[model samples]
Target chain A: MGFELETADHPERLRRVAIDPLSRVEGHGKVSILLDDDDRVRQVRLHIVEFRGFEKFIQGRPYWEVPVMVQRLCGICPVSHHLAASKAMDVIVGAGQLTETAEKLRRLMHYGQILQSHALHFFHLASPDLLFGFDSELSRRNIVGIAAAHPETAKRGILLRKFGQEVICATAGKRVHGTGSVPGGVNKSLTAAECDFLLADSARMIDWSLAAVQLIKQLHRQNPALYDNFANFRANSMSLVAHDGSLDLYHGQLRVRDADGKLLFDRVDYQAYGQLIAEGVKPWSYMKFPYLVGLGEERGWYRVGPLARVQNCDRIGTPLAEAERQEFLAYAGENGRSGPLHATLAYHWARMIEMLFAAETIAALLADPALQGDQLTTSGQRVAEGVGVIEAPRGTLIHHYRVDDDDLVSVANLIVSTTHNNQAMNSAVREVAKTYLDGRRLTEGLLNHIEVAIRAFDPCLSCATHALGQMPLEVLLYDAGGAIVGRLCRASGGGLSS
Target chain B: MSDVFLLDGEQVPFTVGQTVMAAARAAGRYIPHLCWHPEFQPHGSCRLCTVKADGHFAAACTLAARPGMTVDNRTAELDDQRRTLLQMLFVEGNHFCPSCEKSGACKLQATAYELKMMTPHFDHFFPDRAVDASHPDLLLDFNRCILCELCVRASRDADGKNVFAITGRGIKSHLIVNSPSGRLADTAMSLADRAASVCPVGVILAKGRGFVIPIGERRYDRQQIGAAEEQ
Candidate 1:
């Protein structure tokens, strides 16, 4: 860990750190932390340079195309956008309650989406950091590192993600950008053959998901102090829960709980989410800071995603996941949901639990004959406005749309899950900067500590804003007066430059 | 109709009045086309059926099938030009196939695949085309219009309704409804009209009946464009 500093000759400047291409996350991002001459961390901000104006561009599109068109938001979790947009259209078309087949098919697709997306993040993206030390040599801290060092885990992860994709292909008609979910109902139901094929593969997926849960747990147990304290913070948790107060990723009322797992608000209809959630804009990043209106913007900032969903839900629906939940609850002692999630790294554990639950749910849906039913759609009196909310793999996703009498979308407001966790991610980055980089030497591997905190949230900055291009991981050091005093660039091909 | 021509070195016979495309069709060959439907008079707007006839580029749908004339139909160069033409049509309009109801059944998509077109190879127009949903049973999404004028031919020549017409020229050319309100609902183009199903793309659609045909089972799902043309 040595400096390859190229200075701009500002002798009075101490140092400034900027992490460009926040490596191994969902999309392109940069984190700039400014240190003053007093060696104090002056400012730490996460910058999303791309401006994603999807909500604005989607205006005037036919409500039906919204499901498929909105998939451009994030390649990883396009299904979340697809389904959220579809749910919104269901209301626009006056499809109050979907046919049994339609709802089951949609649920199946969603579970597959969560199962695949979570598996991808845990095994492909985050495992590199978790398996290898965050400060390990750059070459050995990616999915390749996991594959070389831990072959069985890598194989399991790959197989789990593939099976989840197969499930999606069967339900949605295509693995990528499937047009299954329409305005009123799903386009097609699963054939008996498709259902049986997924059933044959379900047990393996379940076993692999359980293994993932065990793997994360083992890692947590090995370093309890580090796992519990890394980027740990107190904030409100939000997610969608079923009518019975159980985990329901597809559709339900909003439930928000504090850090102690005490209910701040539960069973709040998401249609009135505007009354509860307010977005704050900062010129630095394109990502919006969404906070609860009741607490106001200052203290209203909350966390969503695996940690929040696990913390906020009363219980999971499936038997296997419910059992795992019991073991996870032990970590929080009597409270169960509160303390365990405060450890940001525990998101991996919660994510695996959800993946297992998704697998279990997929199996149950395959066995149900409703998937083979012919009643795929139903319609009633049309409405001019509709709201859809779903717990996407990332977190709670909200989509509100208003259409003219001609059924063309007149207005669209989308609150992506990644944007919801923007403030929390910034806080985590600030904590890492203070803890690791304030008075210490700025080195290559040490910078990854900040990225580790962000990876825990699995934040899709592409959804927060957008871009995905592989370039040198640049750290541009600036002076107090905003001149580039020093610079270090970690090239994408595993070389360093100054 | 038995006037014979050497088409790609194969002898293809045609009627005295038949064009190269009609002759190829009768002889169990396929000349990729968009605007030249068999049921209507050939209007060579979309140059998808371009071919080398006697060492000169010609529209196969309009070129007369003269006896003993050499023609190159499926040569590499001709297919390349067809691919370029298809790419141009694709970029000139908003032709997103993912959510389109006519995705698997569209002639433009089928022709592009048959020509082995990998990409549009041009920046998209991102055209802000109008969507008219005034009709109770039909939806007119103008975004995907390729200006092929099949509906125009079908309405004027076959259905006698004159419900649709192509107005303007070149990039500014657009399809319009022949109604006082200039809306599809204001016209008498019902589901039974020949113009209703004559669209080669998703410009006209039935309301409340999209995505009913599963993607894999649509017309071009299993059958390629060439095979469908031959049939």
Candidate 2:
């Protein structure tokens, strides 16, 4: 019993919007696009229906306990939550100046997560369509199908994924939600034996990944019509942490570039994100629309995730990973132009390249002896405003927190990587509509197209939607004259954001 | 008091309040142990951490560095003792090391390999222990427990909450949660709880969260962690 908004009024177009248990996604969410008389998108509505109320609940709590407390966000990317929260706390408590070894260990964990999550994406979730025909039934379209059809490849994927997770668990404390990382440095130190084990396995992982890259290429060749050539969309690109004005995932400056090889901005200070970008809140979806700071709402098209990071960066960092980067650069438009790299097909290629870089980079970090620091936290508890930034598997994630001297969080703002691409996502969603929808009733192909558009950014709703616990979706819609049209709402089991 | 021990070829100061195992770790030596987690009290359950202290087999983790006390962490007798201890651990529990998820990270595996003791060389106990998958995020398989008491120590001391306790005697000795439900799944376990990640064996597993890291690439597949003590 929910209402669907078909049409809405001018100026105050949207009165209500409804989104049911959105199908086939990992979590639940809703989106409503308000339209004018001519059916042009007038206002975008976004509302986080369920309230985890973490902001309210976390008050007066011991400040040091936030990392473990926040790890409940998403099981898939607990490290991201742990690191982001820890970094934020570092700003609050004035801590976490880790040794070279500590920094390496921390980056190793980030790489481990990147590899594990991307492997899960390619092998379990996305590969089914390519391996089996795209038209395969929803029931048969799963990891089991991948296992039955290509056991070796599936096993390889599983092993690499697990290995990445195990590396983090071994160093951090737990596989899903490790506590070894603290405010200052890591609580756990690696023994020589542990280091050797990680090194040997990661070496093997490099080889296995190269083989998988070949498999992906083969799959691309096998189904070029359906899978190889992806829908093309072009836009401006942005990424966090660039090494000397190039893309560096762990610690670099933020870079934004236009589609025509023109550098819009490079290594911009993190504190200037708001001054550089502005956000628009719609009454339809909970997603925030970010536009160029002064341009006002949705004026510029921006993209993030794999393709954007690759294009924004000058080159991949690691020596071994450089080869993969070369391969990516070889195929895409010249070193200067963005070209047709915005398609979903490009995400797979960029994902594999990033996987190699993560493995190699993490291996180097674990081998660093200085990381075995004596302290994981510091003494001072000076609260300050700070921003913690990291490139999540999906894209760049930022956590900006304002706290008082007591180290209690005062104001918290998050700019998720997925939300940064909201305009680009809507553009692609409409592009998919132009390419496949053809005004047909939402067919399976059309739905797949929409999924494909979202998948290009590899949106992590858990990260994008940062509320915690028992969140439900509520949608309301109204007519052009501000008349009630339709509504849909339902409650769901909500999870914590790590 | 200043003391010294001839390690490898040179003499080094033996400080007070330092366990022989910790000294060995600090001096950059490998002394394998399962019941001697860095954060827990010593129980010497597995007995693989045995070192030659004062010309006798002693658990390095619990033995203090004393004035004029000589310790040999690497010796033929100590190797033989570790092998015997591993053999006993192998014959006493349902340690199907091959199928165990903790095979790589297991202290037992590290100690066994360090002592060159691969084949159990004993009859399998094959105890049919109950497995609990009741917790929202952890697993407990009693069959695989070697009675190291690390989990108990981790729960009681490190975590400041005694979630587990030992029951029965001798061969009947088994670990049990303190809850009336007698199940691990029923406990209030957050991932932050040391007990959640402190198990040295596969007996206590985190449920719905294994197989993410594949074999040939496990965290401990290649190197021994204790070797860091040497550096």
Candidate 3:
């Protein structure tokens, strides 16, 4: 359950620390830290314990069913899976290009998914830590506590999430496991009444979403040191960008940027992802480490999701969000230049910005006359293999499928957003542990701080691990002799014990 | 006077020799079931409707109701057993709900939802079943067949065509077409036939008609099977 690290002063001695069942993110994971005899942190590993073989079991199903089936991989972001798989199927069916109505409806669903998912992560999950101090009373560090302390903010968060869910239901058919999107195209379209329903509260949603950006800005400004250096490790960034180099979550070409904000790759097709992106496996974790193909194992690790998306994209398509993005980039530093933002805490700010973008995009799509078109699907000649990629709320998600002559899925490989950020999350954890955990007495707050670093990425272990049940995080510290010196465990129901 | 049985403390009236499942359905009470259709003879397959009558366990679909007999259909123990049985059915075949066109309306899925079965619990059998798309109007995805025999009974008793029957045994047992060519296209099976809609899962579906009703508005989307049946 633990590893050993040797120090120069004590060649024969080793130290170990472990965090089991990492809590608050979605699904089970743990962290192991190895410290030298001199108390210097040597190594950190984030271990994902659960596995659901979506890739293996999906092999024999019909290609048309891949979209609906693969979506079961993650409950929190099923829309992402639904859309990604649908797009892949679109290619398989030789309908790579969708009808105007079909494309707009899918776009609406994708934006709604991002809005709701980001709202849940910020309001329900991370708000407790941000609003209250990391070491605040465990009882008072949750959405309920947020409601008690700041009712309007909590209410706004809930309503915003409700609006997003409503959008999902209106477009996709249900909030959870919807079947609106099908191979070649979507099966349904938004009626004028549904569009009107979203438009009724469109103004309020946009305003609240903008206010979320302000709130996060205030949090960051209030605690610069904590937010800036919490897990400040430089890494590459990746996202999908429109042909005009604008932010596009549902459809876009691939783009990657190095830590210095220099473009590593741009406008590349996702079908060629293997040529530019490679996955590395370690013995300690079930999650694979994906890095830039040429950067090698050590330096190739890159970050994805909100922070990366915000940093890698040139501009937001919607006007309101575009203005907010300009202000956000200026505040984050190096005016008028595009580059990766290394601060891990910036993810919350970026997430708020994306939520605003999603709201604005929803408004724009609703106003479009093409959205009401009667055409919903187009059939074409079937193909054997296809790839689909989209920016899920978490980050870039890819679904690749290969079918036999019978049109049964012979292979399925999914690269979820969390898996793309696996290495970076572990690196961030190590950075935080080394900076905060000085080999002194470990406190509950210290353990939570390490968790804070991972939460910043908003990693969805449920999607990554494909496992069921709650994730209860536990942390253990071992001395030079590899004996347990300290322990902190967080249960699934928001209770922490030592 | 009609005979009455005590079901979970409620008095449910039933005709003599009527099965517990029929009695429960007549009384607007839902005993989770598959393979036993109202118009068809009880087949006693898919033991999901197992209930405790007095002290013995029996399939509610076939267990004849007795006057004043106390039947336990909604007990925790029965629910747990039902969940395990549902899990076995799930892993025994590839019942991928997310991808199924009949997902929300599927009886197997609705029953599982009613019983609160979360994970499959057991390893997937991943059986290499055939997808019979030979029929011009209907699609038969054998991978999703739960062996409920609803189609078999409906075809024989209601449609009088004997178009579908069960062949093989144990894990290998599956629904088969009765046509000389063993293909749905060669059979007299029509979309209008009761057998066409008798499947409890995604095994039989209309071709080019997937997701026509959309997802959220499907049969069991908002309401569980128990409530949906009442409507």
Highest DockQ model number: 1
Best by TM-score: 1
lDDT of 1 by residue, B1-231 (tens): 277999899999888989999999988899888888889888887887888898999999989889999989898988888888899999988888866878889999988888889988999888878888898778898989988888888888889899998888777989899999998888888988888888899998877666667769889997998887778
- Per-model lDDT: 0.84, 0.65, 0.84
Task: Quote the lDDT for A404 in model 3.
Answer: 74
Question: How are the candidates ranked when ordered by TM-score, highest leading?
Answer: 1, 3, 2
Worst 10 residues of 2 chain A by lDDT: A1-10
The residue pairs found clashing in candidate 3 are A14-A480, A16-A478, A18-A476, A19-A475, A20-A474, A21-A472, A21-A473, A22-A473, A261-A339
Clash pairs (backbone) in predicted model 1: B1-B14, B1-B15
Q: What DockQ number belongs to candidate 2?
A: 0.02
* CAPRI docking class of candidate 1: medium
**Model 3: runs farther than 4 Å from truth?**
A1-12, A334-339, A464-473, A488-498, B1-99, B107-139, B143-164, B168-173, B177-200, B206-209, B216-231
User: For residues B28-63, what per-residue lDDT tens digits would candidate 2 score against the true structure?
Assistant: 666777777666667876767777776777788888
If you assessed candidate 2 against the hidden native complex, which CAPRI class would it receive? Answer: incorrect
- What's the best-to-worst order under DockQ? 1, 3, 2
Give the RMSD in angstroms, all C-alphas superposed, for model 3: 6.1
Error of 1 at B36 (Å): 0.7
lDDT of 3 by residue, A54-74 (tens): 999788666766777788888
